[model samples]
Target: MGTTPLTPGLAPSPGSDGTGVVEMYAGDRASQALGIVVEDFGEDWARCSMTVGPDMANGHGITHGGYLFLFADTTFAMACNTEGSVTVASGGDITFLRPSHVGDALTAEGRAVATTGRSGVYDITVRRGDEVIAVYRGRSRTLPARPAPPAAG
Candidate 1:
């Protein structure tokens, strides 16, 4: 299988549209297990939400930092891959602003800040109602498309 060439601002190939991206991400077991939902998305932007539950809480009865990072990362992935490229996180950092309690609904909004060559930068904000819970910055690198698997008999 040949890799798709990188084209800036190009729509993703077939099955890579906004809805397709959401559908493809639905196969992610970890995200699904965490109850992450892709609420809405467009070119260079995405919004996702997840509710804090007991399983996601830490010893102090607050939402764990890892869960918050995962939420931001998922949103970043959706925002960067909107252009049809197979983008992966090169690096990321997060700052926890406040503790989130169980039953709190967390929403992560990610937007692309810059895209140069095959690399891009994105920022995500996790919020509970009007309260900011966390902020995340992610760097992404676009990789060549993976070869398709051989057809089944």
Candidate 2:
């Protein structure tokens, strides 16, 4: 997984159909299936958003914890990978500040708080409007480039 870092303040802004970093988001089936959109990104930061759907609700009639985690995780992925490196989350944890219901639109903004070598710490805030819904922290590691496939015999 390799890609060129996106130029700052470029076009094809999120919610569109493309991204600058190797179009990784374009190939991301999970985010796509969840209707998560990379709304914007720069260098080591990214903003993503999605609307809560009925399917995302738990039996309690509120959004499931897993969905919030996934949304934040996806935003974390976008933030870390902005450097064009093949980054993967080593681990992550979330703290829910409030519960959201279906039909509520939520946004997650992620910033790389610190980066030394291949390791980085990211902080993400998930919000519904001006109200904070959750906060997430993620650790990421950039994977080494994969070896080329064997040549044709």
Candidate 3:
């Protein structure tokens, strides 16, 4: 899981149907439970949003760091998986710069910074309005192809 420079000219293009990238994120239940919504994504970029409700706040009445990380991680996942490959985060780091209170609507934007072979690096910024609240960096690796889920009953 060492950091590798993103290979040039290797960034995948948007899916042919345009909606395939979005469909990949629709199956994420944990993000949904946290009120995360995928706003837009294409190629190596993704944008997602979440509202800071009571349940997301810590004892100090500010949004928990874990929640912020989760939001950014979800955005990173969407950005890296746009190519239709099953990707997983190998590791990530986040820096908190500001506090978010209840009712604040936070948006995370992620972009692929580098990629080589089966590994990639992404950077995500969490913002409230125009103010940046946190910055996140994630490393991802594409996994071996697995069988798709069985058709819905």
**Global Cα RMSD, each model:** 8.2, 5.8, 9.0
Clashes of 3: 2
Predicted candidate 2 versus true structure: per-residue lDDT over 1-153, tens digit per residue: 122133334454434333434467767877778888777777788888888989999999999999999999999998887755689989999999999999999999998899998899999999999999999999999998889999999
**Which is better, 1 or 2, measured by TM-score?**
2
Off by over 4 Å in 2: 1-22, 149-153
Cα TM-score per model: 0.82, 0.84, 0.82
Alpha-carbon RMSD, candidate 2: 5.8
lDDT of 1 by residue, 1-153 (tens): 021111224444333366535455746677767778777677878788888888889999999999999999998988887766678899999999999999999999998889898889999999999899999999999998789999999
- Give per-residue CA lDDT, model 3, range 33-145, as digits (tens): 77777776778788888888798889999999999999999989888887677788999999999999999989999998999999999999999999999999999999988
**Model 2 has how many clashing residue pairs?**
0
Q: Cα deviation in Å at residue 66, candidate 1?
A: 0.6
* Per-residue lDDT of 143 in model 3: 93
Report lDDT (CA) for all predictions: 0.81, 0.83, 0.81
| Model 2: lDDT to the true structure | 0.83
